[model samples]
Target: MSALQIFVLALVQGITEFLPISSSAHLVLVPVLFGWADQGPLMDVAVHTGTLLAVLVYFRKDTVGLLLAALGSIGIVPARRAVAGSVYGKLFWALVIATLPVVIAGFWLSASGLHAVLRSPQIIAGTSILFGVLLWLADRYGPRVKALDAMALKPALLIGLAQILALIPGTSRAGITMTAGLALGFGRQEAARFSMLLAIPTLIAAGTLAGAEIAASEDTMLWRDALTGAGLSFLAALGAIHGLMRWLSHAGMTPFVLYRIALGLVLIIFFWTGSS
Candidate 1:
């Protein structure tokens, strides 16, 4: 990829990763659009790292608290195993545990030759539209559950399970998880916040996987591009997260729903025209 392509993909990664817009979809589509996606593992690493750092910085205090709590809670005890061992610790570990589904699935797919779907534009478009509609309905008619203080284990678990859908490229992580949270009685803003919190571990795992692969790569020039992309993504991701929270807190999911629908339709149109 050229410097311009790296830069644009970085911008897209930052902007799309946090929003209910699918970053993976954009990473694929945007590169395809500009014909810039001769992307290597390093480029993927850059995107993942940028988004990961964004979450880490945004939630630094929360991560610190969780680490402290988890460290303190560590001991040979069965009761505590069900718990993070403390408030922050439990939530942190819950996020980690919840991330297991995606990790297992992603790693499995990596090893099992199922990663081919990552390149499928049709699957991406279909998932984008389907989940887009689901998000719209979720915002429109969800039960509007209470906040985290009132949250129970079952609801959290269910939401985590729902997040598993995001392993598909077009299923936005934020969109699906928040929709699941809303289904379980979380208010829009609360659901949104929980979804962001959930991003912590997921990003960490993604970064780790992408990072490992990138580290093993032989191309230094791609690493330079990856670094540049990571930097841009980090910068953009912060603003994206802030804006998404602010919008969802007061406005709900209408903006994201409309955006998704528009994007999906445009993709479909592009495909139709090309085929003809």
Candidate 2:
């Protein structure tokens, strides 16, 4: 990939990964729109790794608390009763339970090769518009009383189930999970925060799988390109995460919904015209 292609793909990944807009859709669309080749799995792994780092940095305090909370629960760190009994401890379990559905689903899809079959522009357009509407409805009508402190098993499971849809090209993991959070009456910031935290495990699962593929493949991937993409994506993702959290503090998901709908419609037109 040229520098321009690397820069554009990295920028798109960083910005859209955490938003209610579908990052996977954007990544798929951008290449087709520009007539560029697929950025390949190595690039996917790199950009995702970068965003993972951004989430870890932005939520550093929560990440540490959750880590301690997990250890406390497992009796790894003895006499940490207070941490074990706190909300973070509960949240750690909530996250674990929440991550299970998607992991199973992803593995199934990979084994069946159905994941590749679902990567077309038509699928993306349909999912983007459909889920975008869902987000709008959830944000407009769902009660916003609960915060992260209120996270529990039921809500976490519901949100995790919703995340399974994210395996579809345009059904964004962040978007669907946030929609579930809002529909469950969590506030916008709270929903976004949990969605991001949930991404930690999801990204790890994805990156690990991608890494294994790259390692086993005969094709040589350019480490230079991967590193460049990772570095640029990291900076872009950090800024995007910061911007999203600040935006949610005072606003809602309306703008992102509009963007998703518009992008979906545009992709639909592009798909039809190209097919004709």
Candidate 3:
């Protein structure tokens, strides 16, 4: 990949990974729209690793608390009452439970090869528009009384189930999970925060699988590209995450919702015209 291609793809991954816009869709569309070759699994893993690092660093405090709490839960270390009783403890469990649905769904999709089959532009266009509308409805009418601390098993499971829909190209993981959070009454920032936290495990699982593939292939060019993509994506993702959290407090999801809808419609039109 050229430097420009690397930069552009990295930027897209970083920005869209955390945003309600589907990063996978953008990744797919970018190559198609620009006539660039597919980024391949190695590059995909690299950028994902970068974003994973960004979220881990951005939420380091929370990550540590959750880690300690997790250890306590398993009796790896002595259980601290304070840790056990804290929001972090509950959040740790919530994240674990929320992660299960996607893990199972991803396995099934991969095993069935449905993940590859659903990567068409038409699928992306339909899902992008459909979920964008769902996001708008949830944001507009859903109650906003709940905070992340209020996350419970049932709601977290619901959000996880929503995340399974994200396996479809345009049904964004962040978007669908946030929609679930909003519908469950979480404030915008709270919903965004949990969605991000939830991404930790999901990204890790994906990156690991991608890493294994890269190791087996031993592609030197892919390694170089992956390294470049990872560094650039990390920087971009950090900025995106910070900006998003700040913006959500003052402005809601309107801008992102509009963007998703517009992008989807454009894709639909482009594909329809080309086919005709």
Candidate topping TM-score: 3
Candidate 1 residue runs with Cα over 4 Å from true position: 76-86, 213-219
Give the better candidate number (2 or 3) by lDDT.
3
Model 2 gets an lDDT of 0.88
lDDT of each: 0.76, 0.88, 0.90
Model 3 agreement with the true structure over 68-165: per-residue lDDT tens digits: 88888887655545486689888988999999999899899999998888988999998999999999999999898998889999999999999999
Residue 51 in model 1: lDDT:
80
TM-score of each: 0.88, 0.94, 0.95
Tens-digit per-residue lDDT, 1-276, candidate 2: 898999998889988899888888888888888999998767887888888888999999888888888778778765356575567888998999999999899899989999888989999999999999999999999999998889999999999999999999999999999999999999999999999999999788767776676566665446667767877888898999999999999999999998889988998888877789
Per-residue lDDT of candidate 1, residues 1-276 (tens digit): 677887888888898887888888887787678776457555766776888788778878766666565555666354345444346655655666666677677777779877665656677778888998998888888878586665556677777778878878888888898888777777887787778778877667667776676689888875677778889999999888888877876788877888888887887888866788
User: Residue 83 CA error for candidate 3 (Å)?
Assistant: 1.6
What would the TM-score be for candidate 2 when compared with the true structure? 0.94
Please tell me which predicted candidate would have the highest lDDT against the true structure: 3
Candidate closer to the true structure by TM-score (higher is better), 2 or 3: 3
Off by over 4 Å in 2: 78-82, 210-221
